[model samples]
Target: LPAEKMAYLRSLQQKNKRVGMAGDGVNDAPALSQADVSFAMSTGTDVAIETADVTLLHGDISKISYCLSAAKITMNVIRQNLFWAFFYNIIAIPLAAGVFYPIWHISLNPMIAGIAMSLSSVTVVTNSLRLRMLIK
Candidate 1:
């Protein structure tokens, strides 16, 4: 298709929809530039590859789904890690400070608190490592 038509199609699609363009021609550069997510074949024209958001190394369309899936998984892991870190600190900080000493006599020893803090960091790192298995 002509570059003009491609650009027009991109404009129409962008009004209320996300546009994803995949093309290997120099003519596709304009549309690719305007797309929300543009994918280009590594074997395609230089212009197309340079304009695209992602370049498929083997020029395989299936990799796009895999890329998107991995991105979602990575984002989930980040959120989980953030939640774990914050939750651990929230519960551990007060206990370490002896906030419950007046009524329930609950407190964390300094040495144990240090170990627990280290363990919480390990938990976050371990959770992030789970992504390798999931993506594979």
Candidate 2:
């Protein structure tokens, strides 16, 4: 029965699902190994700790919520950064390529183009750093 359950739990990864298992017993080792993210208590058996990706120091479950929240925030920051970076590239590349030169006779200077490129990079980085201000 344990073996069947273990295989069922491990099969989640084959379906392209991100599975997280929290186990402390020796029998939990196999399923924990199969999971993408395994949480084991610091006070768990040695084998459990060895198989887990994350070890709960005080065996506290509340930390799991904090971990999930941090991961969500990180994903949010990544999306925000990607949007601004792509926006900058989409607008700047055409301008730099002299797309406006024929109709408006407006040519982008190489020096100013370099400065603008640098500024966009700085903007993206600064925006990403906003995560540092999030409440812990």
Candidate 3:
């Protein structure tokens, strides 16, 4: 039931999928554990920390934004990587299969493929690094 409740709450949020739980007592432990990510007070019960993925060193609730920001950055990087991987395969597979031979007879060069692979890495890293400049 707790997990279902958490899932319902997650579905209610827009765009972001992060959930932060604040608890100082045992009753909140189950809900805290059900979140995708969680934070607990340093002075909170041990069960709280055991259930949370992160424990706030100073018990400051404000640090929740930092966690959300990190999650957003990670999601963005994942999207970028997925896009590059999909794009590479979509083009490379057709080329490798000789889909263009009927017209230009052009094929993808191994050198170009290597460049594209390297650029994919660069693009994902650069996009991830941009999170550092984002205001929390």
Across 18-89, the per-residue lDDT of candidate 3 in tens digits comes to: 565676556667778766667788888898878888888778888878777777777877787788879878
lDDT of 2 by residue, 28-85 (tens): 8888888777889888899999998888887886687777777789889889989998
Sort order, lDDT high to low: 1, 2, 3
Candidate 3 deviant stretches above 4 angstroms: 1-20, 35-37
Q: Clash pairs of candidate 3? A: none
* Candidate 3 C-alpha error for residue 104, in Å: 3.8
Query: Candidate 1: worst 10 consecutive residues by lDDT?
Result: 1-10
Residue 71 C-alpha lDDT in model 2: 74
Tens-digit lDDT track for model 1 on 1-136? Answer: 6578577766778687777778888988888888778899999999999999999997998898898888889999999999998999999999999998897999999999999999999999999999989996
**C-alpha local distance difference test of each model:** 0.88, 0.83, 0.75
The number of the candidate with the highest TM-score is 1
Give the C-alpha miss distance for residue 69 in model 3, angstroms: 3.6
Q: In model 2, what is the error at residue 121, expressed in angstroms?
A: 1.9
